[model samples]
Target: MKTVFSPLHAGHSGNVELIAGAIVPAFEKPSRAEFIRARVESEKLGPILPPEIHDLAAARKVHASDYIDFLPTVWPLWEASGRSGSAIPFTWPTRGLRGDVRPNGIDALLGFYSFDGGATFVKGTWDAIKSSYDVALTAAALVKAGEPSAFALCRPPGHHAGAAFMGGYCFINNAAVAAQWFRDHGAGRVSILDVDYHHGNGTQEIFYRRGDVQVLNLHGDPMTEYPFFLGHADERGEGDGEGFNDNYPMPFGTGWDAWNASLEDACTRLSAYAPDVVVVSLGVDTFEKDPISQFKLKTGDYPRIGRRIARLGLPTLFVMEGGYAVEEIGINAVGVLTGFEDR
Candidate 1:
């Protein structure tokens, strides 16, 4: 598997998130991608390549144009507003609020465009976010060009970002952008299998009304997890996408046995769908040691997850998502790629 990476991710460092009712260092830090790249190198997984430059048009296919314009200017706007720290949103237009009105102020726009305060904007965040999107597109291009599989080592992981809102430490939904790229490039169907510990609410929302992409997510149940609004079992889909979305909301402390069972079922559905390509939102936060996530997956189990996906025998793209166990992230994330190749 070829790995797509970028040093620009380092620029997006020094950001923070609201965790446990306190401002803390962001778990989705630069070191997470560095460790994964180091492991890919040490394991001789494959050639590590810099991402190709892709125009914003590709991203605009999955994300709203207004949202895209807003992201790049967030830091400048915040700084112009006399803010000194990383830009974080504190208010939201919730239920009964005027969701249709656009707020002009940067502070109000931040909350208007985001579901939570997780996606903090730093001086280099826009560049890093674009680089991550480029990385994903580059890897997806490889698979579309006939490569069996490729790993996009994206940082500021993107599973939680929607078309118009950013949260869960994600800006642009990298996996969703790649999936849309595939469809636009002649793929008849694409399937996104998100193995992140948190539900891929963003991906699901993007494809909820479309039928070209099928989404499957396995994660901590929304009732007891972060982004506690979506990922329910009953959010099957709407309109043309009916019955195309699936969610396995595993409870806290879910072990490999139960998790793998869910994977099996998802794979079976993928087989039935017979998608032209598969995109795995490869998140290793399910690791027992992950600080912010709950699950019991061990490092050894990651390879098995990859092997099972390999059994599908379709071209695959592994887009990086959530995984904050900084020390073990490399082993767990690369284990999946290694297993797929070995299988």
Candidate 2:
């Protein structure tokens, strides 16, 4: 498998995320990608390559024009208001407020486009985010060209970004973008399996009404997780998308034994869908030692997780999402690929 990486991810670092109601430290950081890359090198999983640059048109396919406009330029606009640092959303457009009207000011636009307050942008955030999308697209192109699998080690992890909103430490939804890319090329059904500790709320919202892309997620139940809005098992896809989406929201303290059971069920569901490809929103935050995540998946369990996904026998694209225990991120993430290779 080829690993597509962008060192530009280092630029989007630094910002306090509004996690658990208080802005402490951000669980998503640059070191997370670095550690994973190191393990890939040490393990000699495969060759590492820089991502090919992709046009903004690819992103435009999945993002709202205004929302896409807001993320890359909002920081510069916000700083022009005499704010001397990274731009974080302090307000959001909610019910009883006019969300349809575009806000002329950066602060207002920030509130209008962002669903949550976590996506803070720094000076170099645009370049880094642009590269992150490119990395995912490069990985997608590889899969489209017949590679059995590829790893898109994206940063500013993207499962929480939707068509018009950026939240949950995401600006552009990489998995959604790649999945859409696959659909655009030739794939009939592009199935996204989000195994991140948090359900891919943004990914779900993006494809919730469509049938071409089937979305499934196994995450900490929203009743106790970070993005506390969606991820319930009942929120299946609507209209043409009905019965195409599945969610396995597990309880806290859930370990591999229980989590693997959910995974098996998900595999069974996918077998019926018979999609042309599989995209794994690979987040290892469920590791027992993960600082921000609960559930008791020991480090050793990650390999087994990988092997199980590979058992599906579909072309796979692994896109990085969340995992706070930076130390073990590399091994645990690589363990999935290792398991796939071994199997």
In terms of lDDT, the best-performing candidate is: 1
Model 1 per-residue lDDT at 238: 100
Stretches of candidate 2 above 4 Å error?
A: none
Residue by residue across 41-99, what tens digits does model 2's lDDT show? 99999999999998888778889987887777877797789885668778876788887
lDDT of 1 by residue, 1-343 (tens): 8999999999998988887899988888899999999999999998999999988998799899999999999999999999867899999999999989988999899998999879998999999999999999999999989999999999878999999999999999999999999999999999999999999999999999988899999999999998899999999999999999999999999999999999999999999999999999999999999999999999999999999999999999999998988999999999999999874
lDDT of each: 0.94, 0.89
Query: Which 10 successive residues of model 2 have the least lDDT summed?
Result: 17-26
TM-score, prediction 1 = 0.99
TM-score of each: 0.99, 0.98
